[model samples]
Target: MAIDILVVDDEEMIRWTLKEALESEGYNVRAFENGRDFLAYFNEHGSDIILLDVRLPDSNGLDLLLEVTRVDPDAIVVIMTAYGDVETAVNAMKRGAFDYLAKPYSLEEVSLLINKIVQANLLKSQLHHYQEMLENKFSRILGENQKMKQLREHIGMAARTDRTTVLIRGESGTGKELVARQIHFQSARADKPFIDVNAAAVSSTLLESELFGHEKGAFTDAQKQKKGLFELANGGTLFLDEIGDLDPSLQVKLLRVLQERKFRRVGGTSDIHVDVRIISATNADLEKAIEDGRLRQDLFYRLNVFTVNLPPLRERRDDILLLAKNFLEEFRKEFSKDISGFRDDTLRILEGYSYPGNVRELRNIIERATLLETGNLIRPASLPDELKKSSDLGYVAFSQETAKPWQSTGFNFKDYIDSVEKQIVTEVMHEVEGKKSRAAEVLGLTRFALRHQLKKHNLESD
Candidate 1:
């Protein structure tokens, strides 16, 4: 990487000389006539290192150094002075100068100082990058809703150590991968690689080779020696998605790897030992599978040391509008649209619908709406079939318990009353698609009376 160096001196000769010398050494150099001049330009033209003179017309070098630190504390400062006083150099060093270069310094001495500063800055930058990547990788779970807040707290507790095996369970579109990423990125192995593989996506015939790799010419397709994800992810995280779909034989092999932290290649005999943290995700009902003699009980127990269950989007009604608005803004920029916001009717429709596909479905809806919408708002025409159907149906009580045909045939009088109430509400909403004023006018009732019926039925409108 090229080092950016700034030269600050009142003397024109010194400024030009340092810039020329530094530029000749393949460094980006900027020159300022005085401390004030440097500060004025620093906001626009910042550098990794600043070579500052002790005495200037506007300000002292040490004071300038303090100011620069305030702007960017990581910046390296090397003080230069013609006074060549050991006491003054020591004081500058005490005030956070990386080093002090005496006036009339040789080209070799200047080059040496610049190289040292560059090396130190490079190391600091690498450390910062590692921390930043870890933080960024786990930033997908930000939310104030109760479910996400609890999930964050659970992740925090699990990330306090590296010994725990994490099992993330959620619907296919409920961000299972995001939760797994949070566990690994926040753990001790954050500096190492994070390898992800979908167990169901890879064919069972090739999964063993994919996880354990193969030696060159070991099989017809094995033309070259390949490193498996486990070996590649050594000292880091190995995220296995759709893990419940892994075949029984492959599950045994994976269990062995988890137990021994070692696996043999597809056609090789040597066992490769790797230090990896396993984070697995699955959308299937694993307990039912185990009961049906499908999944191994021991393996399930091994992987479920710490479980995090993500609530689907429908369960977190409080986050629907928040997530919808975020998606709207994201797509607005992508599609180069100047959409202001979702129409109130559109938002109402979103809040009432059951998002079977969860956040992923919501994003897709917003993206499609933003691309198709010509006006500033997302209208009812932009909503999907499920949402539009729900709006027309108004508020039908969803029975948590599956309904039986016998119960439907033997409906009580109260059930008929409920059905009648549902019919009136649906007619009103169907006439106006849930606009309170229009629905109220059609029903020959005041808006307040219509709202009273809405409350009785526990219904909201789009």
Candidate 2:
């Protein structure tokens, strides 16, 4: 792999010698005499590696190292210092330099160090890229929740095969898109495009053309041939959000494509075969739709080859605080605020309310609170009136499950224990919106133990 290396030193002879040696070793080397020149070049075209001198005419190398690292934390910085200037080089290293080299170093020694640094940088770059992708693309999905953990496992299993047609069912804000994205990113066609189409957003007249393309002069607006989402997502995945909202006629067309893997443009004769995966999501119950003859049974079965149900926030009360924290961190960065955390009473309110809108609602609440919070902690007054009212005093009473065993009933010890456990789990679950992990934390129980108790009580989640 070709490497871009910037060598900075006040001495021309050292720069020329090092540049020549590195160039001979097949690296693209650029040299600068001062920190100003290096900074200018870095601003124009960033280098993958920066070699800095500890003592320069313009500025100290430690200061320059800090600037470079701030500009690109992933940049590989190799510092140069005199034998006694090791202390300054060590300081640079502490400030995020990859390594340091003593002054009057041999050309061969510099070449060897560059080679090792470049190779290490390449690996780090690859790892960092994957890490960024995973975090940015999948971090919203906190797999600590039991349902999310199971969904993740299912996604892994489905990614290994092409026959899996996943149907993601959930409430409006339950992160159906996130689940679909996870499937596409983990599948064999991860490198390929993942096309998203909102079936509910398009009109019945245009939805067909949007999914299966349209030839020139196919309709009044069709000025030229246009590729559809299916063609765009050829080898990858096509996420059909609100698939249940597709028009009845379009449902027939979609069903045909699912069965035959072939579709034709609106005005074209030849069939276009696509090796695409379909991951559809909807808040509607397709079985009921089929029973009402609004959706076809064959198509429902085809899409439901594999199904993943996402529980609403109210159902996963244990995850309420965790999700709140995640949202708080995100909003804090978004709004450039330094709000530390939620107040105990604030958290109490958040945990008590049933998030009818699920994770999406929680995100909006955190965003609003982060922006409104003038102090270090978020207070209940920062929340909407509806939330505050619902979660005020009544919520505290409903949510508190930390009473001693002695507080429970005395009649029938086993039955009393079951009742207490059920009540505690139920209350905590309500607080966390059915998030088993957070509920378990609130109730002082393990996730596995909570699941066991939940099964034991046969109690309904919030």
Candidate 3:
């Protein structure tokens, strides 16, 4: 897009000079001899950069600056005046002028200032784009289940309370950290820093100093003063993962900080005050940990002001395929594959398995399958052996001795037998690479009998 520059000055010579110089620099320059003409043109066609002289025939530049800012708060207006004084410059800036230019200013200075503004605008645009991507990536909690809906509602409530501490409880790999991040990014402190640490990943000796800054020479390795996660996350959020694994001794210090909003760094005497929202997550059973003395009860109460409990994947079975397809699309783009969708049998296998590792495990499974798949659609052959073995059709077993034929109102024995036989025959054929003799051998049947079974089950082509 071409940059538009507007020059408003009562002096014809100055207006012509600016218009010529700015047009030479490839800007769409428009010159006006008075504030009345400038305002009329501005109301019709807005410009990117505005140069307004204070000594206008009809109006004051400071008053015009207020009007421009009132109409468009982001308007970049540069004040131009031959009688430039400290008070006039300050007044222009107070009225929302971008900068002040005294009379007899060089074109070089104007070019430099314009370049700086352009660069700043470019950076602002890039930052806005990235922020949008981040919000879209983390804000979505992909599930239509009632539990998930309630969880989102709880997250919104927690985010509204800026100072409240939040504790997320869930099984490992059930998106505890994801919930913590969602709360932080959706809150009022979204623009500030968000730092995260795993309590279990750091050693007890270093974890204290990691949470709170230390003075120079405070310890053997402390050569310089260092700020900790708490200080860095001031006015923002600090996500502490696996909070149950924090050392008991440090828990006392943490409790004091929560209660008093101040803490002394390791080997430091003076207390440092900070305003940080703490969002902690733990997969461990906190009630059990409190009873076993592994976690402090007082600290638990402080961190548990707002709690979000995530449901395991098996309980919300309806969302399994939803999450799976989402992961598949994500991986397909990442791996640069041409895969379109999952096969019907593959979808069944994905939806039937109990995900012990939850969403993270399903993501990994999709990633691996997307990378390894050779066909247009994701088939059962692309899945892991464990998934295929544990699929709904994989474990079917029927015996006449123990069968209750008339148990159901509309039971059809022949149909049930035929379905089971067809599934077994299909699985055997897949295992044997569609070799009828090998499939028959595996099923304990002769070639003729296997052929008859294949024709009956609509597997004649195979």
Q: What lDDT would candidate 2 get against the real structure?
A: 0.78
- Give me the overall lDDT of model 1: 0.77
Instruction: Highest lDDT: give the candidate number.
Output: 3
**lDDT of each candidate versus the true structure:** 0.77, 0.78, 0.81
Candidate 2 per-residue lDDT, tens place, 385-414, comes to: 767544423333344553333342332455
RMSD to the native, candidate 3?
A: 15.9
Give Cα distance to truth, residue 17, candidate 2, Å: 55
Global Cα lDDT for candidate 3: 0.81
Error of 3 at 339 (Å): 0.9
The parts of candidate 2 lying over 4 Å away from their true place are 1-133, 392-462
TM-score of 1: 0.58
RMSD each, Å: 15.9, 16.6, 15.9
Show where candidate 1 strays beyond 4 Å: 1-139, 391-462
Q: Rank the candidate models, highest lDDT first.
A: 3, 2, 1
